[model samples]
Target: MATRRYLQLDVFAARAGTGNPLGVVLDADGMDTASMQALAAWLNLSETVFFVPMQDPAADYRIRIFTPGSELPFAGHPSVGAAWAALDAGLVDADARALVQECGAGLLPVRVEKTADGKRTIELCTPRRQALSTPPVAIPASLQALAAADAAPVLWSNGPAWWLLRANSAGAVRAFAPDFAAIAAFTNATDATGLVIFAPEAGAGHDVVVRAFCPGDAVNVPEDPVTGSANALVAAWLAAHAALPHADGRYVASQGRELGRDGRVQLRVDADGDVWLGGEVQPVIRGSLDW
Candidate 1:
């Protein structure tokens, strides 16, 4: 057993507690996978990340992400939170504007920048997207009411897989009550991580609203407060279908309201059609882990 630096962070938070929480363990170089998984299960957050020394020359650091039940190739909130933790722990140069993260999905680029109000923000460039022609499993009848009239459900993969659907309105997204057992069964059968539904908002401060329901076979996270990767895939779907509500291919996503958290995710699709996810991260706890 050894002591390791640990941080609890709120990613994509509009404030201190209104975002998804992530547990991060630093200097996790020698910890075996079983040990790491045990620590993650004990933490019981939606996801926990272990920061290890860089395994690839191109990366500033490497991270292993785990849920209470299993590990993931990549996850959005964990990636964003891990980047902030790396900077806060002095593992990366304070002045560095960018970083490369090595994870099971491979090397992903991260950008550090200051918001117009001068608050620091972190953004991750998602991997190339893979869209499935049809959902691996049929959409459950229970969720059919939430579907938008004009859009058909699509499945997208960027390390983790999610079935993307358009909702009729932001209110619908917020008001949705999911059937955890059915959703879990669908995800497990489809080999997917979760399902995401999004809708464009008109007068709200944010451009869209999104909700993710991920009930894995091993763990049951009924709804994610905020999800970066799902939102990225939504952006890709919108851009590819010429359905971008915003002319600039940039929009803010509102999430977490149903769970009593307020999360805002910034999404931008560049001219080359690459999607980037950005948001503010807040440190909630700093301590050490003994494992």
Candidate 2:
């Protein structure tokens, strides 16, 4: 068995341990797809990344993103996490401010910035198409539809489709209790990934609070602490409704508190309506995978 270097990371962490966890295979050179799937299941994180060399000269690297259940076209945390790992591993030039990442969704750009305090932040430019889907047929007919009157129920997608809904307040969003059975049924019937709910935040720093849930079927995670793609959809929805004011097209999103995670996702809406999601990643565990 070849030894593969692995890194465990906490993405969007406000602190060292508070964020969405990811398992990154630093050098997945000859690993097969099935093996990677099994490895991801063994790791059992929200997602994992396998870094491979990019054949295209324009791309700095290529990443394969996987969930416990299946490989994904694209995911937010893995991109950010992988970017940090790429830099941490000295795989890319330290002074490069922008790098292209080729994934299942195609090549996307990542912005790297180092703060004055020595914290590194990475942001990924969202895919060109952000979808606002109508209610899916998978939702059980008997199930009570959940959505804020103001926000309505919107299925948003940057890569994987997430049912982006809204609650009246941050309290409701945090306090929401879901019926997993119904969610399971919904996911089985549709290709959509999961649900992401949000509400207006309290205090000053953040504009919205978020919680993500995926019923077992396509994906088994019940609640995701911090989600990058979901927040991008949320930002798009908010921008359309004028729900959250984006001064200079920048907004802060608060998530993962319900699961005891303190995650902060930073969003930037470019003048061209492009949404960029970013945050700091905390490297918690580093080791090797003997598989």
Candidate 3:
């Protein structure tokens, strides 16, 4: 057995323990797919990432993301956490402001910067946003009951697909108690990663409240504390529908409070219609893994 570096990080958190947790294995060059899958299952987080050598010269690093049950082409928290891990491990230049990540979805650009308060933040540019033409899946009765009458559900793809819906208010989003089985069934039937419900918020520190349920066949996560991809898609949906509350096309999303965690995600839809998602990543644990 060889020893490898391991990092546990909280992604999109304003503080420690307030974001989605990710497991990262560094220098996992020779690890086979089965071994990576086994380790990810053992970690039992929403997703675990294995940092491998770059396959493309343009990429600064390559990562393989896995959930407990299966592998994903890409994921938000994992990508953010892996980038932080890479910087912390000296895999990339400490002062580097940009990086290109190679994954199943392709090479994605990442930006590292500091907030005005001097807090470190990482933002990732997601794949081209696509509103799929597939007929909308029937929303579960529970979700349908809570959905906003003014907005219809939409299916969005940016590597992982999500069913996006709007709620009447932030309170409704926070009070939403999902029927996991029913939602899971819906996601499976629609071949989506999860169902995301969000609502606009005012004077609440954040501009939007978001929640993601992923008890689907693709992954084992029940409630994702903070989801990067879903938030990105939400931003795109808002922009496309000309529903952006902010004229700047930027918003902060509040999530995970229903699960006793407070997660914040930063979202911006550029003039070119590119969605960028990012937030603070707090390092929780750094240790060695025996494999």
lDDT string for model 3 (245-285, tens) is 78998889888989989899888888999988888899899
Cα-lDDT of candidate 3: 0.88
Candidate 1's TM-score reads 0.95
lDDT of 1 by residue, 43-114 (tens): 889899998777799999999999888898888899999988888889999768899999999999999997
lDDT of 3 at 32: 96
Q: Model 1 clash tally?
A: 0
Question: Each candidate's lDDT (Cα)?
Answer: 0.87, 0.83, 0.88
Would you list the clashing residue pairs of candidate 1?
A: none
Per-residue lDDT tens digits for candidate 2, residues 1-291, read 999999999999867889899999998999999999999989889899999878778889899999999988888999989888998988898777898988988888999999999778999988755665464475543223456666656667788888777776677787777787877767556667997888877646788888888876666888888999888888888778766555788888988888888899999888887889899999988899898
List clashing residue pairs in candidate 2.
Answer: none
Off by over 4 Å in 3: 115-119, 135-137
Instruction: Compute each candidate's TM-score over C-alphas.
Output: 0.95, 0.94, 0.96
Q: Candidate 3's error at 118, in angstroms?
A: 6.1
Ranking by TM-score: 3, 1, 2
